[model samples]
Target: MSDEACRLDVWLHRARFMRTRALAAAFVEAGRVRVTRGGVQQRVDRPGRTVRIGDELVSPSAAA
Candidate 1:
């Protein structure tokens, strides 16, 4: 992926959602993550999925 786009797992870590990339990947694999762009939302089940700026990501509750 280009610099403008990053792996979903990496983004999750950078955005402080998950403590580590591995955790992010696991969360995604569990189908607990969703991504929205241009008013369309899609479940992200792959950690390697490309994510870009302005893309909205929905992750499971961190407290749980």
Candidate 2:
């Protein structure tokens, strides 16, 4: 996390991935999102997790 870090759910919604913040948080809580940065990749199980710029986010496909 950094000074500019934002909540993962908020970022997801701001990025236009989900139509609503609640949905974004739900998606993250379901462990359907993964983040990769600094050569580290891990699942996002908590919507409140801190996300910073340059962090790579991977979401499950619609068909999943």
Candidate 3:
């Protein structure tokens, strides 16, 4: 990975998505998080999705 490449898990955790790395990985495995760029969606499997600043990230909506 390059220095500019930020892992999805790391970004999620840093951005305060999940409490831990394991949780972030779990969310990805469950197909809850969607990483999108250029108007296309990509499912993230690991922490190596290479996220950049201001990238769109969509997760499953919370239950009411």
Q: Give the TM-score of candidate 3.
A: 0.75
Candidate 1: lDDT of 27?
Answer: 88
Query: What TM-score quantifies how close candidate 1 is to the native fold?
Result: 0.85
lDDT of 2 by residue, 1-64 (tens): 5678999999889889889999998999999989998989999899999988898888779578
TM-score per candidate: 0.85, 0.86, 0.75
Candidate with best TM-score? 2
lDDT of 2 at 1: 56
Query: How do the residues 1-64 of candidate 3 rate in per-residue lDDT, one tens digit apiece?
Result: 6666688887788778789988877777777778888889887766567887667888777451
- Each prediction's Cα RMSD? 1.3, 1.8, 2.1
Model-by-model lDDT, in order? 0.88, 0.90, 0.77
Tens-digit lDDT track of model 1 for 9-42: 8888888888999998998998998999999999
Can you rank all candidates by lDDT, best first?
Answer: 2, 1, 3
How far off is residue 8 in model 1, in Å?
0.3
In model 1, what are the clashing residue pairs, if there are any?
none
Clashing pairs in 2: none
Please tell me which model should have the higher lDDT, number 1 or number 3. Answer: 1
